[model samples]
Every structure is written in C-alpha cells, then in structure tokens.
Target: MERYVLTVTLNAAVDVAYTVPGFSPGGIHVAAAVRRVAGGKGNNVARVLARLGVRVAATGFAGGAAGRFIQDELRRAGVVPEYVEVAGESRTCYAFTDPETGVVTELRERGPELGPEDVARFKARYDRLLAGAELVTISGSVPPGVEPEIYRYLIERARSCQVRVVLDSSGQPLREALVARPYVVKPNRAELAGWAGRPLETEADVLEAARRMRTAGPEWVLVSLGADGALLVGPDGAGAWRAVPPQVAALNPVGSGDSAVAGLACGLVRGLGPEELLRQAVACGTANARTAGVADVDPAEVERLARRVRVEPV
Candidate 1:
C-alpha cells in the first residue's frame, strides 16, 4: 500500500524540555515543573498527524544514546521512524514554557555534521521512502557539511517519484530549493521577506512577494503569520485571511506550524481544495496553541476552531 505521507527530518534530534514559573535573571522561585521528551520538526509533525489517525513514517539521521533515546521516544509515541545511524549522536533542543505568560523560550542545537558518505546514505534512504509516500514534507535547517542545495536535490528527487514535496526552510537552503519548485513551500513572514530581498510590510506586500516566488516554481506558497493567520498562493487559489483563535487562552505556541502542515497535507492527500486546506490549517494551529509541548490537540477542539476559520479567496 502506498503510504499517505512521508516526513523527512534531516536535522533530527531528541528534544529535552523543561518548564519553570517566574523565571528571573539570577534567581529562581521555589515552585515549578519540568518535562523531557524526544522532538524534532518532522517528528513533531508526524506525532500530530499520527495522533489524528494519519499513518506516517519519520525518516532521518540518529546516533549515540541521544539518538537511541529519540528513536525510543518516537516508537513509544507510536511514530514509526526510519532513522539512519549517522556518525554523531542526535542533538538536543530545549524549551522552557512559562505557564503564567504563555511564552516559550527555545535553545536549539546546530545539529550534526554530515560527511559526503553520510549524505549519500540518507539520500538512498529518502529515495526508498518516497516510493511509498503520496506527500512528502522535507523540513528544518541544513546540517553541517550539507550543501545548501539539499532541499532542491531532495525536492527534485521526490517529485520524480510523483511525491508532492513541501519545503519549510529558510535562508540559502530555501532560496536554493526555489529553483527546483517543490509542490508547496511554507515560509513565515520573515523568511518570505528574506527570499523577496525586501521587507514584506502589508497583506499586499505578502501577496506580491509570494507572486514573485512563483517564478522560482512552487505550485503553492503558504506564508504563516503568528495569530494573524496565513496567506495562500497558487493553483488551487490565492487568498488572504485572519485566524480567529478560540475563546480560550493560548497555553503554548510550539509546533503550530507543523500542525498546519499536517492539516494541509492531510487535505491535499485527500484531494481537497485551498478553502478546505486553510480551514483545517487554521484549526490545527489553534489546536496547537491550546496545548503544552508536543501534546496533541483534541480533534473536537479542532472542529470548534474549524467553524471559526474564515477564508477570503483572492
């Protein structure tokens, strides 16, 4: 059976997280809480998708105890990860979520340095996986020694297999991938700004900037705005809209983008249009905001948020 989705997490890691109340520069309060678990961009995405009853396979690199730990954690989460044992151990990402203010501060790793052989090995694995995937999401930054053109390379490879590729990266890596024209590319405001070589100041600016990017080739370009919502540009339709978060206060803001990806990917795999895509995308994002780190959003909550999503097709 052809898999519905395949997620590529090149710079994979085991995320060790914690939380504390009333953080201060030099002192700490007596009361607090802490939690640690496995995490990575694609892993986070797959976790949400699987929890939503979407079958997924997480593919990338891993090594050492940290790598084993992340692999173990993913398996425990019921996520099937095909992790290649790279030369070094997996990296760690730390997040401190403050309950009172709903602020999350993250300390991220630079990630593993891949040799040419390591890159070749991962590429082979990616090729094998693409054969079974209907949609593929290749996200995160480029690791050490990895070429900036890796996204372009992978996007081209996946497309050759008829796999819909989504690129969610920034800087040189994203700029390079534009040349290959993945099926979809999600760049938040700042990232789209850099890619446009200017400041994306207004809704018009965002729409126009994305238009210029079409010359670089993605079929759909989605630009996400925190709380404000996202703009979609491409074959299905072009639109601008705002997301109205549910009445409840936001608990945390982590993994919101990945949630959007899962929602949109799910719709795409089922042949849904942009209205449906953005509807689910908005709901997923709001659902993410209502939870702690990596914990799933309730489907019923997503349904609630979905009802509030307003899409203005342009």
Candidate 2:
C-alpha cells in the first residue's frame, strides 16, 4: 500500500507578502504588489510536496478566521488539511521585499497559546494520522504555552508506528528533540551554528559540527548552505556528501528551506539513493529561490535544475 507524507506545523499563520521598489527604515514606502497565502514551515513543505505530485497531509493547531483561511488556501493548493482546532485565533505574518535588493524583512506575530486541553486534542489527532504516514516532517516553532518537549513526544510517537521522521526546528525545541533521534534533521548553516553556540567559519568546521550533531541522535544531518547548496553527513558520521546547486538569481527565499525538506521527503518516499536525494533536495531549494511566492515551485524548473546539481561524496 502507498503511504503519504504528513507535515506538522505547530504555529501556523496567514502570510502576506508585499513587494516594494526599495526599503528605507523610518521612511514611508508603498507596495508594488501584494500576495497572501497560508504559511508555516510544515505547511510550506506540504504545499511543495503536493506540487511535486506527492501524497501529503498538513496538520497542526489552527483556529479563528486566519486558521480558516489557511485551511482554504491549502485545499486550493491541493494539500490535505488535517488541523486540530483551538480556542484562540491564529497568527499573521508579513514579509516586505525590496525588488532591487532582493532583501526581505519579516514581521511575525506569536501564535495563540495552547492549553493542556488543546495539547491533548492535537495529540489524539496526530496519533490517528500517523497510521497512514510513511514519513513525517515536523517543522516550525511551537505556539506559546507549548513545551519544547512536544517535538520529542511526536518523534517518539512516529517511531512507535515505524514511521520515518524529518525534523526541522531550532533553539530549545531542536535541542530537546535531538534526544528522540529523528530519522533526519534538516538545519541551515545558521541554525547549526546556533546549536553549536559558536560561529562556523570554514567548511571543515561545518562538517565537524554536523558530525558532532549526528552523534547526538539524528541518522542524517542535512545542513543547507543556501546558494552554495547543502552538506549531508550520514548516521555514523563516516559517510558524507556535498551537493552543489544550479546558479539562479533568487527573488525571494522565504520558504526555500521548507521546499528542500519536501524534496528530501520525496526522495525518501521514492527510495532514491543518497546522492540523488541530495541533488533533488538542492534542486527544489533552488527552484523556490527563483520564485517570489513561498513554496511556489515550478516542477519543470526543478527538473532542469536537478540536472545541473553536482553531488560528490566527501
């Protein structure tokens, strides 16, 4: 039987993007174009997975009008919405982009706090979804009042069902979840550096840090390096590979990381080899950077870029 990939976003939002000619702090600026959509790391991942023709379902805490908008938008984009409702309203986020500089500044609101009752409800729903999930990608920040241990609990639950899990998070949450030993942990260079509590200055430093992280729990540590592509370190820290992406002038990079997560999930479901998986992951990230909207990737563009991705074992 074919299984689907399930994506979880604890703190969801309605994302509004505005494009401006240029930005100046403390100066009035007008938007040239505006677009609004449902957003959260897992939600974006689910959207990209759907675009790639993967079977995907998005779940998490959602409430109020903003939550309804998120559900409608995800349905419109062909992603299955399986969110658990709460009492408080969902959050909103705004991204301001400067066309000339390709710089984006984000203004985000903290989502509603989750009560004990809310947590129990979500956990029940999540348990039901795990039965049909072959792979699970848990991404983004937890809402207020939610403990960092939430990731650990979810990871353990997925593992109990023999489901592979890809975790994308940072700070205390990432630190806590590492104990659960996720199947894969996807973090960017910056997040890795933060986890290390020191700046990673050289390639060797990055590789060493990833190796050390692998010792903690994750089977695979995939570190994203933006335009430079990504680095992958295997379970034993002996197998390592680097994937170089195709060059493209990026317009907006809001959801590129989440796009990469989707690509990784796709590769896993398709049973692709390590090298091929890294290549596809980088290609998807590159494709997302080529577009202005979050998770708005072109499948043809991804294929074109995939051909140019260079994957080499390190």
Query: What is the number of backbone collisions in each predicted candidate, taken in the order shown?
Result: 0, 0
Q: How far is candidate 2 from the true structure (C-alpha RMSD, Å)?
A: 1.0
The lDDT of each candidate is 0.79, 0.94
Task: Kindly report which residue stretches of model 2 are placed more than 4 angstroms away from their true locations once superposed.
Answer: none
lDDT of 2 at 68: 97
lDDT per residue for candidate 1 within 1-314, as digits (tens), equals 84768888888877765666765557765436665666777877787777777888888888788888878887887778888888777788877777877667788988878899988898998888888888898778887888999889999998788778877889999988988889888888898999889998898898888877876888888888768778888753454444444555777777888888877777788788777787888788778887875646677888888888877765
Evaluate residue 167 in candidate 1 and report its C-alpha lDDT on the 0 to 100 scale: 78
Score candidate 1 by lDDT: 0.79
How many Å off is the CA of 220 in candidate 2?
Answer: 0.2
- Supply candidate 2's per-residue lDDT for 38: 94
Per-residue error at 276 for model 2, in Å? 0.7
